[model samples]
Target: MTSHAATPTDAEAIPNLNTRNVALDRVRTFLTLVVLLHHAVIPYTYFGQTDAKSWIGFDAIILATDSFFMAMFFFLSGLFVWPSLADKEAEKFLRDRLLRLALPFALAALTVIPIAYFAIALRRSPGTTFAVFWWKTITVGPWPSGPVWFAWVLLAFDLTASVLYRVSPNLVDPINRLSLRGCGRPTDFFIFLLVMTAMLYIPMRIYFGPGRWFEFGPFSVQASRVLLYPAYFMIGVGVGAANLHRGLLSMDGRLAKNSWVWAVAALAPYCLLWALIFVKRGMLENPVWLPAWYEASYGFFFSAFSAATLFAILGYFLRFKRSGRSMLDRMQAEAYGMFLVHYPIVLWLQYWLFDFEMPAIAKATVVFVLTVVSSWAVTGILRKIPGAARVL
Candidate 1:
């Protein structure tokens, strides 16, 4: 839908776009914690149960987090790209992206990922040495990137956006206009996002079957979500193109006021996803190849739940915690570093805890808390090193 340019009143109604958005920083910090929690509880979950103890609650948590967090991270990462591009030369932006994303991704793939997955290898073959395992992982096969995949993928998106900007700076003006309309009617933006993601996601999920990944050494991504992630990223680029505060994300906007509505919207599709899970397990008997209809249904519900959850989380922060000086604010600086470094801490903690006879909840709680504290502490220490802040 077409809309007029942002008026002075619209700009005056919210915080300056040029300034920091405390709420989004907090949201990013919260997502970092979610990443930690997702990994922390994976060992205890029913589906991914690597430990003797398993919990249904963890399965639920995994289902919800897996459906949306990474995509939302891409969206959030894209949010400031337009402004950043405007402020810097294309070459400078690429260089900064390489330093911030590619370098860390390379380092983590070489060191952090190997170390993290070594715990699993150790569990499988107690006699295996880290040196041997690392060699095989690097030279022979199956070099999983772990969470650091986000860094490189975001860098790719950044590169693509830079080229697109060079082609035409107003490439995303339509979405920006849509975002402006979303200030009062967020449902419009939500629907647009839902439809776009579903269009991009469903057919790919049916064709690729969700379990397939495209991998090359440390670079790998889920096949079904490859297009989906870029869509979210571009939408974020659009929203941040201009008049960010005067658009959908305005603190004084209706999206913030109607946070509970999005919560409700998220719940319905989430429940539908669970229902589809039951259908897959019970009726379909977890077939090697799911029916096309089942995959389509699952994909739609997945996309819907993801879109709704994004709004729910963003709205909650924009409405209630926009100005807070909480733990999130304190951890904001270290959060990205924590995300980069937490995987090894989590896996190693889980590995050590594996032999301990504890309930799943207790083990998960211990793993999550220790991982947070350890990662935060480690990131803080690393940031003190000369020149590390630029990369971390």
Candidate 2:
């Protein structure tokens, strides 16, 4: 969700490129809503349910969202990176990224994350004071970054892209060429993405397992998909390197026309993933350490599903939402800020509803609606502070 705003100089350097892509803006805002929905329903899923009521439907929803949303976030974040780098001095680019990404990540890790996680701590020990819990979290151990981990990781990727840009501006030229070809044949790009992600994700998943995360203080990342994310980011950089309008995301492109095909492609691998999950749970007895073969198979389907879903979602937006001001357009300016602040609202709502007797679906619906409205309102208010709009 990096800003797509371009300077006058950028318009000169990249001719025919619009300052903003309404479709992609809508896509990013939609993803923010997806993130909200993911968190809201997770507590009702069979795997993560902490409530008295659990629903299998929520398990399906979690499965789909968990598979691709964050990786797609990285891809969307990367789409504007190369252009930004090319348009500004290296120092200026890095400075802007630090202010936009790193600063928000730091503030959220220190304040937002602790407040959100305090709900969990309170569940464990009702008498735990916020000050004591916050101190223990920061000083002692296990300071979870929660969802804001994306911000810091994106900062790292942006910094890396800057260094790579300095080394060779043409480093991603091959990807740019591929993107041009993908204008008419998006399957090629999808195939390349699937292969790249599989190579990066499958082996690491086998080695580290799906649940293993590399954590240090408030900085944590899923070990299995660390390389996978950067791969997507770099691909995004390549696509936006040059001739962005005439490439894979072109409004007149086949990618938009064949959106349904990509949707089918996404569905196939997603179902395969569920089959593997069933085999692991029912046949393999859900072992603590899944076999390498299971992990490999699962990893392949996961990668395929993720890549195909990225295309499906992007294609749908490009095809049907290329113009006009929708609700997503209205939310675009506030999406990133909402993402940063929603965790606390979601966690607190879940905690408060823990004692309620409502059905799982009803409770999840309430949480999702309230989190969206509350987070959007909070972000709007925060943006009103002087100099806050620059960061938020």
Candidate 3:
């Protein structure tokens, strides 16, 4: 919550920044944190069971986070790209992106990920076998359990965005010129996204099936996590097209000026989210009332509500600057690396904590915090290590 330093003193010095990227980054952090919460606390539906849980009451809640994170991350990528495309030559941009994103992915896959499996094993009472886990980690490539796969998806998105930038020289001008003029209102934007995405993804699920393709060897399931997750990424593009940021910020800036009112309004969206989850959990105990329509509604509401709530909350925070600018700078500086490394630590922590008889939610919360803090701590410690600081 604490910010360390200001990003920039004046808007003029920074070129072409609209309210959208600001809103999206804040929203991205929140969704990512929520995702950490979901992963840290998977449903009792499967881990040790023989069959998958059909109801997906608990699983459904997490599903929302997965797609939401995807949508928001890609959106942010696109939003940020407007500048990159406009600013950099295509070859230079692609070179930096590949060096920074893809290379790290390969390195993380080879190094950081192996560290994760070993970390989890060492944390074990008997431990993960050195020979078994080492070979598995290396020969098998990245798995779902680690966060490394995200790096791959990120590379994909970056490559896609860079290509879009290239094509933009010819095609984007006719379309993108509108951003110079400005975009439509936020409400109109939200409804547009909701309708468009529902029209887009729902039928795909109905026809193509939800199971993943373009897999990593036997880990076919990970294909969805890598590629299929981009619906949110496209949604990110949609939010940009809608010009939702400035309007939301204009509204949020006003409300944030009145802290009490803004805080209360911020809580409103969450009340419905929690209520829906609570009711769904209890109802699923009995199958008689289940309906196919309800499943669709779940996805619809989850997608819609998450997008709206994220922007609203982000608009609220960024509208008002807290004094702790340095904290924000430090956290933001560290957050990228933190995200890169956190999940594997969380996975290891799961191995340690999985047997505990705690509530699903509570256990997840604990692991999430531990992983986040540990990632921060690790990054900080690594920052001090000889030569490691440069790569980090």
| Model 2: pairs clashing at backbone N, Cα or C within 3 Å | none
Q: Model 3: residues >4 Å from true position, as ranges? A: 1-32, 43-64, 115-128, 140-142, 170-184, 208-214, 217-295, 320-329, 355-366, 384-392
Candidate 2 per-residue lDDT over residues 1-392, each given as its tens digit: 10111100011123235556678878888988988888888888777848888899988988898888877888777777787787889888877877887898899889998998899899989999999999999999788888888777887888999999999999999999999999999989998999999999999999999988898997888999889989988998899888777999988899989999989988988898899989988999989999999999999999999999999999999999988769988887788888889888988999999999999999999999999999999999999999888887
lDDT-based ranking:
1, 2, 3
TM-score of each: 0.95, 0.95, 0.68
TM-score of 1: 0.95
Q: Candidate 1: deviation at residue 224, Å?
A: 0.6
Give Cα distance to truth, residue 155, candidate 3, Å.
2.1
Candidate 3 lDDT: 0.50
> Which window of 10 residues has the lowest lDDT sum in candidate 1?
1-10
Q: Write the per-residue lDDT of candidate 1 for residues 293-326, one digit (tens) a residue.
A: 9999999999999999999999999999998378
Cα lDDT, all candidates: 0.85, 0.84, 0.50
Best by lDDT: 1
lDDT of 1 at 369: 98
10 residues in a row with least lDDT, candidate 3: 1-10
Higher-scoring candidate on TM-score, 1 or 3: 1
